[model samples]
Target: MLNYKTLLFSLGIAVALFSCKNQETEKKTETKRPNIVFMMSDDHAYQAISAYNDKLINTPNIDRLAQEGALFNNASVTNSICAPSRAVILTGKHSHLNGKIDNLSKFDTTNVTFPQILQDAGYQTAMFGKLHFGNNPKGFDEFKILPGQGSYYNPRFITKDGDTVIDGYVTDIITDLTIHWLEKERDKEKPFLLMYLHKAPHRAWLPAERHYKEFTKKEFPLPETLFDDYTRIHPEDLEASSPDAASKKYNLDQPKSRKSTAAKTAEMNILTHMVLTNDNKLKDSTVKKLGIKERYLGDPTNRMSKEQKAAWDKVYDPINKEFEEKYPEMDDKDLMKWKYQRYMQDYLGTIASVDENVGRVLDYLDDNNLSENTIVVYTSDQGFYLGEHGWFDKRFMYEESFRTPLLIKWPNRIEAGITKEEMVQNLDFAQTFLDAAGVNAPDEMQGESLLPLLKGEKDAWDRDAVYYHYYEYPAEHAVKRHYGIATKEYKIMHFYYDVDEWELYDRKNDPQELHNVFYDPDYAEVREMMIKKLEETRKKYKDSEELDKQFIKVYNDK
Candidate 1:
């Protein structure tokens, strides 16, 4: 019964309300999807970062992420090796499922990555720095990666345009490219996922010329297990001369009468096989006086420009001169100690440049008011040894190399100054990204989302265990193939490429993992429990001896 004028007035009111509500919803949806910047360094150990352990070096800039947001106390990777770890993070599955079991195996581009999912969800995706995979990655819209093990000075980057040698330190160059992409190349309207990887603190650790003298005066404390004799172990019996020998039949759980081959490997010992001038980043003439033959001491700084080499000489010449004067009269023990010191100085020095560039990224985010809606994650491909167990490389399930550093900052969602103690692995990162963007993770993904843990809701997360597998054997460093399950209190593994051996550790009693307590009578109940758990974990991840054979076959064929 109302008139036309009143009816038109009421309809206009409803239409205006509807339009305003729609605008508000659109604005919310726009702000909800956070920009993810995952920053990673190669072989960066949790022990070196001040956020976890500050004995070796102080990493203030990297610590900012943990302080301003949340630090993951138990973050780890499915595989301990490099390329396989990277592949696991990209796909939310184990290496067995992803087909990237080791560095030798090419990453199957057919596998689904988190960036690919983000791209489908309307994100502007790009990767800068070392992807370290061949056949050119497919997910990122733009990629400029280091060709193989990139140089520290005048590093060459492989891009769609071809390989371009950029004249600068690799860390600084990578950061410059990242900033350029953010300011000039990236689309601001859409959310972005940027993978900024670094080759710093990797093999043949090289620092910038500026930081050569940074850690020269600081004498780092050696690891408690630095002189570990490998006497206390549970090694499998050697192959017998006769095929019918009873001892040849192995017992995987043999606890006593064990021996380890870690100290004998010539790949990464600071005292033995580490090239003098190359690994230590010293002058050639100075190293020559130490009686190290020129053939043994390779050149790591051959790629440095004239200016770069001059700056390097400015710092190293005096140090090397001092070393040559003192090393001649020293005995084997003193010489070994000197080598350890040199290795620590150069290794920690290279990390300083990484810390400096991280500060640059943090400052850029703060200055541009981009920190609030963006999630910043800092981690490494895998942890490396800082002379632990008389070794200096990864590819073992030991605690030093098993646990990587993981720090995340998301201002809008994750509360500041939070520490998540729940066990989480790199594989969980993919599902977490998908959940953040409101996209559904595929069923094939094997990891659970860490969204709740990141939000400081630890009670909501029930995962208390993680599985680790390292398959690179008869390769670099010569670590035997092993897989294990590590919970908060226990760790048990099988080193089973040729010989079968089971090792267990009570993390509470021996945090350093110095003793293999697989046969200790006190830990009998614990070992039985952990063995069952390991079996469950292997079955859950669909990792069996049969699948191991397939992975090994593919790796060998490659």
Candidate 2:
């Protein structure tokens, strides 16, 4: 009995409402695809983490991630160097496959990275902070990265559009970029992949002013192997020497009255600071005061030998006058202490700034609702030796240099207060991230998915062993090129460069790895069994076929 016009109008309204409802449904479905955020810290260690029971440092925000989700106690890197580890994390492939075996090596970015896969799947991807792989980030939609080891204070970042040299602490700058990307430019219809990387507690332990005195009062406990003589296990010829010996011996502990004292201090400080800040430039006054008598500055033709006198003249002429003016009464010891304290302050100050920025990033994530959907992972390039093993730099296969701290959190998916003891590697992180996003990982990746382990499904997976290789030898740390296989119970290593040797440690009996048992009569059978397993692993992981032939060479050389 309704009129035709009225009936047509009612039908039109119903169609409009139905269309709107369908659009809303589609929007909800899009948002339901989980967003992913992966974060990392350079050279952060498990021993430094308060959550892992070492109470000397306060990393409350990093600890919060573990509290909210899961902490993997045994996460390790495949190649324990900065570039190689990062490459593995990006490509989910071993160093051999990634073409990044050392810090100086370049990465081949043509291969499928998890970010690229996510982007292909309609996710918007972005990376901010340190990306030191020395290749253009191919998969990310947007990226702002530090040029090499970015400064702890006022770092310089390079972007696809242009390079940006920002005037804030590095951590804060990275976080700011991340939040800005999230709030402004990101597509609301698509899920996001935000990578927030940090340069914290890396070499030179440069903390900010706030964290300067944070751990100053508490004496850091010396490592168990602090005084270990290399002659006992590793022969003197094979043992890697500390990089900071020049600093520690001449600048750190030596009396500074010697004419070359200031010069040595300045040199060490410059090298140390350079690692933290790429923009580090020595002041004229600092140079003069340090008595650095070298000035090959303008003469390209002047060689180090030919310019020695000229260099000495240029370096010391002003310094000598300054020295006479500044310290009429200062003795050798006084000058030494002054130089040592200055170096320590600058280095530790940088570390404080990094920690403060960490707090800032944590605060930002919390402020945004995106934190619930995000997974924050904090780790380092590799572990650093802070006077451990009498060393300062990394690259050795030792525990202090090899074991990095790994903290992860995903609010909705991961279970809180769970600690996984499975042996995990940095190489596995890429696959894990891809798995979390339900993306297909490429076949070239050597890592296995850790999703089940992260989710508290302990019985769902079984991985018994982890492998390690360090190829950059006779360079910075003088660490011999070595490869090793470690399990939950034992570890077997072979050093093939410089001096060929094999080392074995039964972790159940000697957890500290103080004694090498490759030559032990008690472990002969164990050694035989491990050798077979190691070969099998090498083949399975597609490691160099040369490893098998080199084992005998290692034994014969030793």
Candidate 3:
């Protein structure tokens, strides 16, 4: 029998042991959730980033994410259009399911987004820069979005308070707002989802004052397929009928045999349709002498202030004069070279600003001690054509336009300098973010979480192929509607609506995608296998002829 003192002492010791054990258990279970900083640029190409290919441009800041974390070699999008691609990212579903099939279609508000789920799970959410569609973005605690294809100079931002036009380069302004939110507005206690998007490198590529001077002086190497003739279009077909005649033949109920008009129908050839004054920044008088008319839109410089206009003239005036002097001697080939150079100068210049601003955000994270617990992701809305296939826009299932750049860094979690070849899409971003935070993704979400792949768990991922669709046709650029499945070795696309064509590519043999091997007898076995895969993928995704007809009806009505 113990005395009173001994019994009390024993009781106290037991209580202390129990309390310590409980605390240890709590500590083990309560893992700190990671903050996500998602940075996306508009129309940024993988080829432009030096991490993927150093031949095109040197993007040291963007490459920093790739060096410090994992670079996805096979990251792509479901759809290649801007607004539709964005909708897919937000909803984690394909365009057909999300009801944002094309840029003209309104976004379905009833659908749940990952940001909404994150916000519900006690994560602080914010979005800055172009949403590209809706003004009032759901699930964000704070947002300042660009009003539908915002300008490069003196861009107007729509905010919760009201619309405010900030007077600076749009790229710098967007970065400034993002950093400001990080430093001032972000809640310290909770995890955050920050979307810092850029409007630069979109349409009418306008660079900041600092970049245009040097970029204009430097000439970039032309793409090998810059002067690509439409080899898919036959000689007789070229003289058969125009796009207008083909549109009339396309029946609403039952489509006609449009054949393989995919290559020739589009008006995206950089030499002809890319207007001199709208895209290339030629002086109005110089364009008049060259027999060029402003076809795309009015001069992009018309929105500039006096000082901005003066600075633009200071750089472009000399280039215009040189072009005018060379116009007499310039042939079609010479003109193509000149136009390609001009396009690259302005396009790449915008990217330089994006790279600089990305460095700013990365440094802020490092300086603030947020690097260890934060997940930083970098990507684009979708890949752009940097003169690949003799085109300047994205509306195709081709490799250059289909593939987007994806880099993710999470200190002490993801191993540095890793490259993943698994086929991941923007569709996976939602579930990945939710999974990283220990939140359950909604059942309606269709994307697989990339958390395992990000953490270097290669065997945990088993996806061998990805799906792609493009649905903006008889519209700008005139890219025919198509959807396909892409494995590492092969790709098959079916162009429909105005044309019914099944095109296949042997990716391993022809990396440039210069040849279509659909009708080749040698590839019959491969074609049969790919066709079965395509049908299975389409069915797995719940896309059917009914959905196709429904979307076509909506488009025709519009």
Candidate 4:
């Protein structure tokens, strides 16, 4: 009915409208991929999180994540060492497979990391904070990480472009870098993956001045098993009986002198910095009197002349006075206990800064309308023993050191406050990230995707047990080399350092793993069944061959 010119005009308008509509739809589809922010705190434990019903202290930021998403109740690590555990998380492989079994070992960055995969898949990936694997972080489009275990106060960062030392608290610097990247460098057209790792609450616990007085007025309640004597509970053959056990041991009431020979030696090394001019050489008397022992105390090399010894005596005089004042009546054990308390105060206080920074990240997401599209995850490198089993550091197969807190939040998906009791490990993090990005996990990865569990598809998932191995032996923390398998119902740990010791725990009856039933006459069948299961797990995970080789290599090398 319309004229030819009118008909042609109508068709042109319809085509223009369709084209605009298609462009809008394409933009919406492109933005549908979720942005992921993964955060990790150094040495954070499961029992320290308030969301996990920890009544001791508050972790509001960590609690918020749990409240808004799923909190995994039984998340653990394949290895309890810092570098090794981090390597496992990045590669989704066990320490043996990754060849990063200890802190001193280097990480192979050529391997595929989830961030690398995401980068390849057209996502902007940035890592800000501690990437302590001692290797260059590959695959990240932008990276500003601390060179090893960074300082708590005014830490240094190794940037992707250059080595620039930023002045501020470690947490503040990390957060600033993250916010800056988000505002300036991140691509708005595609999703972004940001790894925000913190160097808080590590050894020599140093807290910011603001939080220094946080726990000064209150005394943390000593753990119930503070006095647990490993008489019958732990086997003599266990790796916990290693010679280096003395280093990891802690007491509850003793204060140690902060100025020991080691401290003085460190001070003397820095004293050279105070030398006014190049012409001023270190005085021989000053050097000799500093109690700088070259070797054993009574060795001929350590012997000093009267004047030299006198100077040494003067330098050590303050140390002796401080030591005597700190522990006038207490023995070494009691003195250690006092030091532990002070250490705990500083350690827990450091966590306050971490909690505060976590709040900042959450607030940023909410303020920018990114909360709905962001998947937030909070966890730690590994767990630490806060006076548990009379220990202070990690690397043990014990429950306190093995389990880590894992919390996740995604506003568009996942229910709030729901806790999944399924056994999960750090190795699963890579696959979980890959799954979130709709990317297929690599075949070499040992972890299973947790997407189903997060999506409330528990019935459709098939996972029951998780494998663990700690291979760093004759190393730091003195925790014996061990391997084990943990299921929902039971746990079996085998210590191979000494007389082959086996620890079996019935989780349903002994959730705390207080009792070792490997020697119980009634559980003989159960022990055999668990051992068989352990063997089967080793074989299934392709760890048996490596374990055998490691056992032979350790003895042969020794």
Candidate with the greatest lDDT versus the true structure:
3
Predicted candidate 1 versus true structure: per-residue lDDT over 436-529, tens digit per residue = 8889999999998888877767477887679998888778777878889999888887877665677778787888887776666556667678
- Residues 15-101, candidate 2, lDDT per residue (tens digit)? 999999999997875457677777777766666666875444566666787888788777777777787888878888877666677
**Candidate 3 minimal-lDDT segment of 10 residues:** 250-259
**Model 3: runs farther than 4 Å from truth?**
1-30, 232-260, 294-296
Task: Give the clash count for each candidate.
Answer: 1, 21, 0, 11
Candidate 3 lDDT over 95-214, as tens digits, reads: 989999999999999989989999999999999999999989999999999999999998899999999999989999999999999999989988999999998789899999899988
Best by TM-score: 3
Instruction: Rank candidates, lDDT, best first.
Output: 3, 1, 4, 2
Two-way TM-score contest, 2 vs 4, winner: 4
2 against 4, candidate with superior lDDT: 4
User: Candidate 3, 43: how far from true, in Å?
Assistant: 0.5
- Off-target runs (Cα >4 Å) in candidate 1 are 1-31, 233-258, 261-267, 283-290, 293-297, 554-558
Instruction: Rank the models by TM-score, top first.
Output: 3, 1, 4, 2
Q: What's the lDDT for residue 252 in model 1?
A: 40
Task: State every prediction's TM-score relative to the real structure.
Answer: 0.90, 0.74, 0.91, 0.79
By summed lDDT, the worst window of 10 consecutive residues in model 1 runs over 238-247
